[model samples]
Target: MLNSINTNPGALLALQNLNATNTELTTTQSRINTGKKIANAKDNGAIWSMAKMQSASSSSLNAVKDSLQRGQSTIDVALAAGDTITDLLMKMKEKALAASDTSLNSTSLKALKADFDSLRDQITKAAENAKFNGVSLVAGSAKPLVFLANADGGNFTVNAQTLGLQGLGLSTTGTTFTTAAEAGSMISKMTAALLTATNKLSALGTASTGLDTHLTFIGKLQDSLDAGVGNLVDADLAKESAKLQSLQTKQQLGVQALSIANQSPQSILSLFKG
Candidate 1:
């Protein structure tokens, strides 16, 4: 220690310590307010870049989820139409059997024929109306619905199924039966058509189930990725709360230390007091 008023080394050291303490306090306050340890590149450039990249990836996955949801809707509409068509097919089968009876009165046979024709028209209407977002999966359209399976959208795509009744070997005309022998012949053809329709329904059911399974996996994966990003950037408020108290106390001590250091120069005045 030198007894000189020209320079105060202790005071200089105290000021530097105070400045350092203030810098730390500012950073702590920022974390408290923002609740993010890496709020910007100034905090930690490397970590901020990593967080941004992960956020972009999560956003891409969200887009994929959106596409999948639309695809689900489209498939659901087609499946519902398929179900209605199956019911109509069953009714038509019953009509064909009744028409095959060799002893039925002409009036009764004619009534069955009219009912069969009405059902065929209904099947056609159902297929035409089974549409979503302009996508008619069951209307014999060549428009293939594609869904994204990944964020990049480069090598991942899922094609949805398109269904049509006439394409599935189901007769859309009710004029096939004329006589008893002809009605008998239609039995085998109708059975085959029903079998084909059943198989197509099963296939669609399987495809729809696969999409649901993938959706579940995607939802879980998105959650995990979100958590990972949070881990990299989120601040621990509990830890910050403790640090806030400690820094406030240390800041007060720093100011007092600087005051005490400044008072040392005043001691030189004591020598000249007399």
Candidate 2:
């Protein structure tokens, strides 16, 4: 090979190889540091875009889960209140049956009526106080509770159930048991009210179960989406670690080769001296 002091082809070739090795080294280091094979759109545009979209979907599912949780809590409150009302109605029925006995004195009938009225008032109080986050399902409200069901703008609804005195076909002014006839009339009303409250409580229980099921499904769906994104972009750290060491070794060797090439022009001086 002909060599000259003004231009050294070997050194230029060595420099080019070294620059290539440096570029590869930078890429490997970035993979190790970021723990992602495709950290940005430039790395792999199609895969990066897909992973980003899936990540956004996973994030949106978080809101859906939260809405379901709130709905579940509201239903839970209503169920608890409904159960209390059911128990109160059962006790009121017992009082009305006792008051209906013609053998009972006036004083005894009045006492039973007082007890029945107190229990009826408690039922109204329970229904009114069954609120969660300003929402009450059994308080005679007409609004239904709606919750996000998925990332695709879907929703779940729980229709409101009124459990008030008027809603249960009872008198808001309280029932009277002043005579055997009045007490007998109250027994029929109590039976109907008990049935109505039980049916509404059952409906609320079903809604609660549905919310729980969907919440579980949302959690699993989010996990699957996150795993999909990871599969698309997450780096294999073990492979990157090995490649990093290899590239670093290559970089050092490249530098040494360039130094040797730069010294080759000095060999031509030895020929002149001899």
Candidate 3:
């Protein structure tokens, strides 16, 4: 090769190779630092874009999970209240049945009537208090409970179930049990109310079960989406570590090559020596 002091082609070629090696080293170091191969748009535009979109979807699912959790809590409260109402109705039925006995004295009848009235009042209280976040399913609220079910704007709804005294077909006026005939008439009403309360309880229980199932599904869906994003952008640390070692070695060799090329001009000085 022709050597010149002003312009050394070997040095330029060596410098170019060293610069390329340095660039690769920078990229490998970045991958190691961030633990992601495609940390930004510049890494791989199409893959980064897709990963970002999926990441957004995964983040949105967090809100959906929150909504579903709220819905599940509300349903749980309603289910508890419905179960209480059902138990109260059963006790009221017992009172009514005892009061219906013709052989019961006036004092016994009065005691049973008082117990029945107390149980009926407790049912109303339970229904009214069955609320979560200002939403009650059994307190005669007309609005249905709705929750986000997916990332696509889907929703799951649990219709409100009115369980008040009037809603259960129970008389607002306390049943009269002053006489045998009056006590006997209350037995049928109590039976009907028990049936209504039980049915409502069953419905609320089913809704709660459905909410639990859906929440589990949402959790799994979020996990799957996050895994998908990871597959697209996450760096393999072992692979990167090996690559970093190789690039570092190459960089050292490139620097040595450039140093050798820079010294080549000294050989021409030796040729002109006296």
TM-scores across all candidates? Answer: 0.94, 0.96, 0.96
Query: Every model's Cα RMSD, please?
Result: 1.8, 1.4, 1.3
Worst 10 residues of 2 by lDDT: 171-180
| Cα error, candidate 3, residue 255 (Å) | 1.0
Candidate 1 residue lDDT tens string, 144-252: 5678777888332334343455555655553367666666676676677667767767766776788788777888888888898899989999999999899899899
Q: What order do candidates take by TM-score, descending?
A: 3, 2, 1
**Can you write out model 3's per-residue Cα lDDT over 17-65, one digit (the tens) per residue?**
9999999999889988998989999999999999999999999999999
Please report the candidate that would top lDDT against the real structure. 2
Q: What is the lDDT of residue 227 in candidate 1?
A: 92
lDDT on C-alpha atoms for all candidate structures: 0.79, 0.90, 0.86
**Model 3 spans > 4 angstroms off:** 174-176
lDDT (10s digit) by residue, model 2, range 1-274:
7668999999999999999999988988898899999999999999999999999999999999989999989999988888898999999999999999999988898899899889988888988898998889999664787899999989899999888887788875756567888888899899999999999888889989989999999999999999999999999999999998998899999999999999998887888884
